[model samples]
Target chain A: MSGQLLVFVICGAFAVLGALGLLFFHKAVHAALSLALVMINLAAIYAALDAALLAMAQVIVYTGAILMLFLFVIMLVGIDRRESHRELIPGQGVVAILAGIGTLGLLVFAILGSFPAQAVGLEAANGGNVESLAALIFGSYVFAFEFISALMIIAPIGAMVLAQQARLTAKKTQRERAAARIEAYAQKGVHPGTLPNSGVTALQDSIAVPGLLPAGRISTSSVSQAMVDRDAVVNVHAVSLLTAQRFAELSGEVPPAIIKPEPVDLVDTKDERELLK
Target chain B: MNPEMVALLAAVLFVLGAVGVLIRRNALVIFMCVELMLNSANLLLVSFAYAHGSLDGQVAAFFVMVVAAAEVVVGLSIIVSVYRSRRTTSVDAPDLLKL
Candidate 1:
């Protein structure tokens, strides 16, 4: 095969793969990334096809700006969003696949029947791809170009208008929140003040490490309940081991090289246990 | 490569995009499939430009890109707004139009 045909085959294969990835990936972010791959490969094919300017624009606009926008919005909407597999209409998948294959066959046949066998390459017409494109844009399609600017202006304005959230109620002040908290504390005996800060131990200083209370008990309110529920919270024994070792070193005691955290029975206050419950 | 090969590739991508639109549930993914279809069209335009040895097809492709960019911005914003109100990106969630 010729070099141009080779380029087309490779890029076209990758583009098809990427498009398939976009369809099959469960996560929105992954699908977005796959779409980006397809775009970049398509740009490569564009360059191979002698549309150098369009190739650059494809890389810059589609892969760079548009895909990034898609990613940004994906994150905004929810990056971990898994597409629900429950089809609204029964047998939609089979129907869609059949339709797609039929369309593809029809399109392929149409192209094979009508398309020119020999490509009259853009060597003479595109003396300079940039220059010729610029002339067409500035000379003939200038009015459409000007209208596109109007479209560009209107699009952003419309986006801004759509994105702005309308407030349905008055904003609450800090005092209001505090008052509500105090009322809850008085009526239901809930904690009124801010929760304890996350742990800052000698070797482990992560939010998953619960704060050490004054009585050497782990503060129930320090770590997030979500972390606790997930069993992601750092063990109190593990965090305290380093602190104990450091204290031993400070007091001129030779600490063990590998101090395995032994199970230490923590004194759980009734109120704190109730708070946890 | 001949215009037919590029046209064939574009057709495949276009069909893939159509299937994606039909089957995918996420509104954003559907929007992306729409973009894929538009890109396929742009590729065809560029290929035809090469066949005719004229710059007009490339110019048309460039216009498609501009319109596409604009469409993405507005489409994404609409998706964002819808997500905010509905708290889900599934295309089937907003079924108020369904009879």
Candidate 2:
């Protein structure tokens, strides 16, 4: 077989397989991957068909950009999304497959009936594939190319407008937020300023660790109430030890032994205390 | 391969894409099938360009690719917007107009 024919056969088989995979794959991600396979093989076939520049464009544009866009959308939409098996119409799958095969048969019949016995190859017309295509694109189809440029601009703007979520409420200004906080503070004993910053110490710098108050007690407001409810608050004993050690290092004296706080296990301890009662 | 055989292959791919569009429920999958159909058309255009010994068909195919890129951007964005409000990628989920 001629080398071109060999290229066509192999790529054609794989392209068809990939297309079928696109059809039958249950996962959207898998279907996207299969479509990418089909696109790559089609680019190979385009190369065999003497559209060398087109072949490269096919790989770069379709496989590189478009399929990646598809995969991105798939991920955004949720990769684990299942393709609904429940047909919208009864027996739609069977009917669709049969119709597709029938359409393929009709196309084959038409091609066989009308196509010439031999194709006139592009060897003479293409002095160089890139130059000739450039001549055609910039010369004859230049106006169409300009229109395409317009389309390229418009499409992204349309996409942006379509995908953008309209803001439902006006954003509050800093002054407005401060006023609201003051109003709440006047009506009820609520803290007006921002909550104390989460703890940062040598032993533990986690949000679950409450910062120490100026009075040397752990500030409850520093760690969120949610953390306390979930029993995720870090023990302050270790942090106290680290602080003493650092102080001793600075003063060149032995670190004082600090008493450990009773470990707080609010939910379990409450249940245990009830059981003991 | 002969241009005719290449034409046959393109036809097969186009039909496969059509069936995929029909059978697939996910909007993203359907969008992919439409891309497959467009790619198959590009293949046919390239093959005919080879057969006729002219670069016009290839140029046409190049135009198709550009238009397809623009179309995909708009179409995918619409799909994403629909998904955002609806929280499902199923094509049938957005059937508020259906009685």
Q: In terms of DockQ, which candidate is strongest?
A: 1
> What is candidate 2's lDDT per residue for A1-277, written digit by digit as tens?
9999999999999999999999899888899899989999999988888888999999999999999999899878777766669987999989998998899889998888566678899899888889999999999899999999999999999999998978546889999999999999999978998899977877788888877655445666677755664567776655676687788899899766554444343223453232212
User: Which residue ranges in model 1 land beyond 4 Å of their true spot?
Assistant: A173-277, B96-99
- Which ten contiguous residues of candidate 1 chain A have the minimum total lDDT? A258-267
- Model 2 regions more than 4 Å off: A168-277
Find the 10 residues in a row with the least total lDDT in model 2 chain B.
B80-89
Q: Per-prediction DockQ, in order? A: 0.80, 0.72
Output the lDDT of residue A111, model 2: 85
lDDT of 1 by residue, A172-195 (tens): 999998899999999999999789
Model 1: fnat (fraction of native contacts): 0.88
